[model samples]
Target: VFIGLGVPLYQGYGLTETSPVVSVNTVEHNIPSSIGRPLQGVEVKIGESDELLVKGDSVMMGYWQDDEATRRVINDDGWLHTGDKARIEDGFIFITGRLKDIIVMANGEKVAPVDMEHAILEETLFEQVLVVGEARPHLAALAVLNQKEWEKFAADNNFQDAEKHSEQVEQAILERISDALHEFPGYAQIYQLGIVDEPWTVENDLLTSTLKMRRNKIQDTYQDLIESLYKK
Candidate 1:
């Protein structure tokens, strides 16, 4: 199944000032779809804007070289203002989206693409997907398959060729994606998926060395293919 090396555990929050991780998930009182409670030494509170604010022993003394930056985040109450927007419900924390990733649909729906994209990935048809067209009525995705494994499968099946195997890869992914998407709402579902024959790699500048995609670059590189997926 799709899983992470760690507990993916939920817990404490952190700031750049707090050395990045201050809280983590706890098993005793875990909540689904929630990043568990705060760490023992950290203090958390909802700010006027409902943004999370934290103060703790782990909190840095101040910005090392940027004094003005330091004063701006730490208030008279000594709370370090974290720019991340989140909310607490039933004593659990839910981060709607990053400040940058949040999108308001034309119908007033706040869509978090990662939420739906993760659902698509859960099917294993794709190694990665980028849900795009924010603020539009419908959702779309750029999906890249796990081609190496498909290539190996092709040999086992006696396809004897990369081209034949590639075709199978596309068909297999399309069918799997269709089945996996049954749980999504119509608007949230991926109406079309742009398929890329080429894989993403840092050498080609499609991704970072760590493999995080440069979404805008990939979209531009495959613009024609992407729009074609939406064609009737």
Candidate 2:
């Protein structure tokens, strides 16, 4: 839509620690999905667990008056850990998720809930979704339904009750989720789900000022529902 309106919008990737500019797409070489190639004199490489690492003159020396904190991010070789999981293809960068948000299952399998949540949210019936399976057997999700979409779906299906957690509703949602995650690995599939009508927002304390999910707080607030998913 931006391009149709003659607006040349570009996407870029960076962090304050790296002087705030890492990669950017230009009009001459733009890949809508990628964050573009690293800037001149900037070196980027994937470190352990697919974390994006940077080493350049723009990289900060260290955190102010926080040697221990600085040491934790920047290695002896001067590579600053970006804390974002990413992949580089043909010199373009694609951010996948945050390393700090990875969920580790009981069997030691690591799953990035951000990617899974994004996939599930594409169904339109769901307004918000949080995938959780930390130290559990399989992945599960707590989702908030889009009321308009849910009502339409319920009417079309000839359901007398539009109960959020009804067996029929759960089965329908699971099927949609399966289709959305078909490209993902078997381990990434959601085995159980919990439905909620309320949406998480900054006013509700479930989201941060930056609009990022407060995962711990959300989990704690829905502890009973989450535990029931596991119990099933």
Task: Residues 86-111, candidate 2: write the lDDT tens digits.
Answer: 99999999998889899999889999
For model 1, how does the per-residue alpha-carbon lDDT over 59-171 read when each residue is reduced to its tens digit? Answer: 88888798898898888778988766678776677765554455556787666666677777886447778877765666667776666755665666565445542545455
- Residue 28 deviation, candidate 1, in Å? 9.0
Instruction: Give candidate 1's error at residue 38 in angstroms.
Output: 2.2
Per-residue lDDT for 124 in model 1? 47
Candidate 2 RMSD to the real structure: 1.7
How does candidate 2 fare on TM-score? 0.93
Each prediction's TM-score versus the true structure: 0.61, 0.93
